[model samples]
Target: MPPVKKIVMWLVVIFLLYAIFTSPDSAADIFGSAWDVVANGVRNIGRFFDSLISRS
Candidate 1:
């Protein structure tokens, strides 16, 4: 990838590590929220496809 993209990725990694180390509870909450978001996204996609299949 490009240099800028690499730098941004490293920064994100460092920030996540700092967050986890500094506050475990806050980090757990953040990860839980992220999981919920991903689960909702997958559920929505499945519903969309199910609707299309039922209509046809």
Candidate 2:
């Protein structure tokens, strides 16, 4: 990776650690919403493939 990308990544990691330590509840909610979005995307993919197979 480039130098700028590494610096940005480190900043994000530090901010996340700060958020986790300062306000755990808010961080948990943030993570929960993110997980829900990922889960829904995966479920939608599965449904799409299932329908395609069923039609064949």
- What CA root-mean-square deviation does each model show from the true structure? 1.4, 1.0
Error of 2 at 27 (Å): 0.1
How well does candidate 2 score on lDDT at residue 18? 100
Model 2 per-residue lDDT tens digits across residues 11-52? 999999999999999999999999999999999999999999
Candidate 2 residue 30 C-alpha distance from true site, Å? 0.5
User: Whole-model lDDT for model 1 versus the true structure?
Assistant: 0.98
**Candidate 2, pairs of clashing residues:** none
Compose the digit string of candidate 1's lDDT tens values, residues 1-56. 69999999999999999999999999999999999999999999999999999998
Clashes of each: 0, 0
lDDT of 1 at 15: 95
Best by TM-score: 2
* Regions of candidate 1 where Cα sits further than 4 Å from its true position: none
* CA lDDT of each prediction against the hidden true structure: 0.98, 0.99
Given candidate 2, what's the lDDT at residue 38? 100
